[model samples]
Target chain A: MTAAQGFRHGLRTAIVSVFALVLVGTYVSVGALAHDFGFSASWVAAQTVLIWAAPAQVIMITAMGAGASPLEVAIAVGLSAVRLMPMVVALLPILRTPRTRGWQLVITAHFTAASMWIEALRLAPDVPREARIGFANGLGVAFMSVAVASAVGGYFLAFSLPTALVAALLFLTPSSFLIGAIRNSRRMVDWLALAFGLALAPVLALGAVRLDLLWTGLVGGTAAYLVQRLRGGR
Target chain B: MSVLGDLWPYVVLVLVGFLPNEIWRWLGVVAAHRAGEQSEFLTWARAVATAVLAGVVAKIIFFAPGALASVPLAVRLAATVVAVIAYLLIRRSIFAGVLCGSIALVLGGLVLAP
Candidate 1:
């Protein structure tokens, strides 16, 4: 197929991907719940447009709700976003060509959340290089538009929904991520990292220390990496 | 209303929160220009990122704040296990896993509620 057709195909696949829809919907609920937690609706909307990463958005909202100072909230959100670095690193090459413009890369990079990254990594290779960015942008635009609308919808719904349903909505975000991580687990290191992180996160949180997520990630991740290296790679 | 008082903190959070995340994406663009995907640093970074993500997920499941805190630990754990099992059984379909896990959590809550 031609590059234009490939772009259209990628865009269509992304819009129809059930996993993408679920993740986007979960993010919308998260944004709405953040508003419910007392953050201004405008603030949540800005976060959706600007940060555009659901995990970081959730961390920021929860930290703010827990009375963390703005600096603390920022720190936690930043730490939560650390994981996206490798994702971006892994995805940029797949989406870029020798002639791809810098601005195009920048824009697409901004849209590279886990959902997009996973899709792009899987699908971009088959698409013509010239059209990869367009495909990604199409997916990004569609997902973000729906996600923003959902956030607004959830914001209105939050005021009317029962507490139990609201709580379940909140649970959807993390549970989805947990399942995503499990689904993404392919290598021995992936499993080890998850196990180590799962074991360490609660301990750190209960310790009442600052930057608990950051520390848990650093220690758990480093240990997993070392173990994998010691086990002689892969 | 004191607009500054109401807004400045969030503005600060946005700026600070955005930088750390964006910096990585920017770096990724640069690195993708220079290094092959198989570079050791990228591999290590991927491992670290995966672990960090897992840690965050763990925090949410085990030490969830607010309403989720009310659910029993056993229920949450059970739901997660079932979700993973469902994902595996369904050929790693994320939607199925999430749906199964969510239903499990709700059912677990109903059954285990006291």
Candidate 2:
């Protein structure tokens, strides 16, 4: 394929992911939660505008309502966002074109996350570096729009919905994450992280003061890293 | 909502979320300059990111709490597996995985989720 064609193909793939997963699935999940929980519509809207991350936003809203300590909530919310660091790192080779210097990247970095990052990552090999950020930003803009609209509207809808249905919709928040996580695993570290995080949640819940799911991430992420290094760095 | 009341908190929240994001972005750029090539740090980042994604997904599908929290573990798990297979069949397209799994969940609820 011509370079232009390759860029278009990569852009198309990224856009598809933005619409299906980021816009449709993640927004639907968050909208469901917004309708059931007292999460501020404006705050969640701002998060999408800025964070564009689904899992961390969801956890932050729920944890706040639970009256969980600020530290606990921050750690859980912050730890889940650890995924962002690696996500950005993985996309480095792809996004470094034009040497996208200083302020421009800082402006755009807010746009990176699982769906966009993952799409850029898988298809970057074929795309020219110059086009990667544009394509990614395009995808990010689409996801951000859906989330802000969904969150604001869903917050208003919650005032009218029956308790039972609101309950089911709320369930979709985590369900979206669960499905996405299962689909994203490509390496041994992924498998271990999934296993360790899942196992850690219930075990932590057993404690007098839950070990906080956030730590599970630090522990699981660290353990996976160590094990991967030991296994000949495969 | 007075500017000083409900809206103010949100203004602060937006500023807070925005700060870290920018810091990371700058850090990404600075770090990128130093590490033009993929290094162990990047590898570690990828591994941790993958694990986090996996964990988050597993928690939602198999272990989420709610009114439907009573849904049996096996059924929830089976639905996720169906989604995974669908994703694989589609050559790892997450769009296919999420939609397929959501459908599988509804169908499962219709059929076996008593």
Candidate 3:
């Protein structure tokens, strides 16, 4: 298929799947939380567009609400986004071709969030080499459009929404991330990493370390990798 | 000066939020170009990323920073447990799992609210 056809196919897949509604749920939560934190609707929308990672956006809102300086917030948000590096690394090989321009990959890289990475890793291999980039770009754009709209809607709706509902909305982000990570687990190391990360986070936080999340992942992930190695597994 | 003041938040959002996140993605593209797909490094990177994300998820669930913190800890744990169980039982239906978790949270908040 041509680039346009690939794009159309991606748009159809995103809309027809649970992706659009799930994003609506997640981004609406983000919008409402941004409102609660005194951020303007446009700020949240811009965040959804630029960051395009709900967890990092949520971390930014929470940090700013807690009066963290921009530098501090950047550290936290940056740590949260480290996952995107590896995700993009994994995804680019699927989408890249010999003729694929660096600029196109750069654009596609910007759209490489958890969900897009997941979808691309699963679907890009089936796409023609020339069309994979288009397909991934299409997926990213569709998700971004939905997310921005819902974030604005949620910001406006926060005033009328009940606290209980707001709490429920806020839970969606973490729940989805956890489930997605679990769903994508294929090896012993992957499962062990999730388990170890979960087990380590609260423990590390108790020490009040400046970068507890970073330590949790490093220690837990390294431990998991070692365990897999000792088990004679790849 | 006033315009700059008004724009500082956006600047912060881009600098602190967008740039921090976007830089890694760019690095990944370059790294992928150099290293190709499968490698020992890629596997370790994936594991590290997954762990870090899982750590973030654990932080959010256990020590939630915003609206979610209002719900009791038990409620949050229960909701998360329910989500995982539902996801596994429902053939890995993500929507069903999240929906069930949300329902449990709302219900727990309502029923347990004083």
Candidate 4:
């Protein structure tokens, strides 16, 4: 198959795989937010589209509902999203080509969240560089669509669905990430990072609720990196 | 109500929230241009990223807010183990792993419910 065809195929597979999982989590969470906050479905949908990150969206919605000021919500959400930096750094080189336009990269950057990043990182190696952006865009557009729909659906269904089902749906996004981490486990450093992150998260949470992720990430990751370095590098 | 008065706060929130996230991504693009994957900065950054993602997942599973808080710790851990096992058996298929984990959690909740 040609490079373009390979990219197209990969894109379709990613869209299907991500769509099946992403919606349930975002839908349920946004629905819960709407029910709790008395937010309109339209408002929730707009947030989903604009924020485009599930964890941050959840933080923003929940904090705002709890009567946090907009500035506070923004800071918390933005800090939560600091993880996206490494994702974008790792992904851009693979998708970019000398011939690739600046606007294309900007657009791709906007779409680079966890699910999309995972799929792109997995798929880009095989796809021709010229086609990588296209592949990412396909996954991004599909992901965004499902995200918006799920937010709206959850908003309505939050009132009607069984709590158990909604709870199950809430687990979907994290489950997907955990699975992705497992699938991408190639180096000892990766495993160390995961272990440290898991071990440190709860401890960090005791002190800092909103910034726990950032702290855990920095400390745990640096520890893992140092360990790998001390071991003569992986 | 004036549109600006009502919407400006949300607009500000969007900008404030977006800038922090986007700044990192934009910086990443620039760094990627200058540095190879083998660079120390990239390596450390990648490690940090994985840790952050892991931390988030751990938080969701163990210390989740709202409805998920009701799930027992044993069930959550069991579901994760089952999911990991499924991922390995399936040659690391993410879909299979997630499917097994979600099913395990739901089933655990059902069987273990009081």
lDDT tens per residue, model 1, B38-92: 6666666666666676777788788865566667889888888887788789988
Q: Could you tell me how far off, in angstroms, the CA of residue B41 lies in candidate 4 after the best superposition?
A: 2.1
The predicted structure with the larger lDDT, 3 or 4, is 3
Candidate 4 global lDDT: 0.75
Give Cα distance to truth, residue B62, candidate 2, Å. 3.2
Top candidate, metric lDDT: 3
Looking at candidate 3, what is the lDDT of residue A126?
87
Which segments of model 2 are wrong by more than 4 Å?
A1-12, A35-43, A63-76, A157-234, B15-33, B67-70, B90-93, B112-114
Q: Lowest-lDDT window of 10 residues in candidate 3 chain A?
A: A13-22
Tens digits of lDDT, candidate 2, A23-87: 54446556657556665666677766766777667776677667776667656665556556556
**Candidate 1 deviant stretches above 4 angstroms:** A1-7, A37-43, A58-76, A125-130, B1-21, B31-33
Between candidates 2 and 4, the one scoring higher on DockQ is 4
- In candidate 4, what are the lDDT values of residues A1-234, reduced to their tens digit? 444565466557666784447566766677668667866677677676666777777777678778888678767877777788787777777777778777777778888888888777776777777777887877777777777877777776666777676667767767788878867768888889889988888878866665788888889999999999999967
Candidates' DockQ values? 0.54, 0.41, 0.65, 0.61
Best by DockQ: 3
User: Where does model 4 exceed 4 Å of error?
Assistant: A1-7, A207-210, B5-13
Residues A123-159 of candidate 3 have per-residue lDDT tens digits of 7888998888999999999989989999999898856
Residue A170 local lDDT, model 2: 40
lDDT ranking of the models:
3, 4, 1, 2
Candidate 4 TM-score, C-alpha based: 0.90
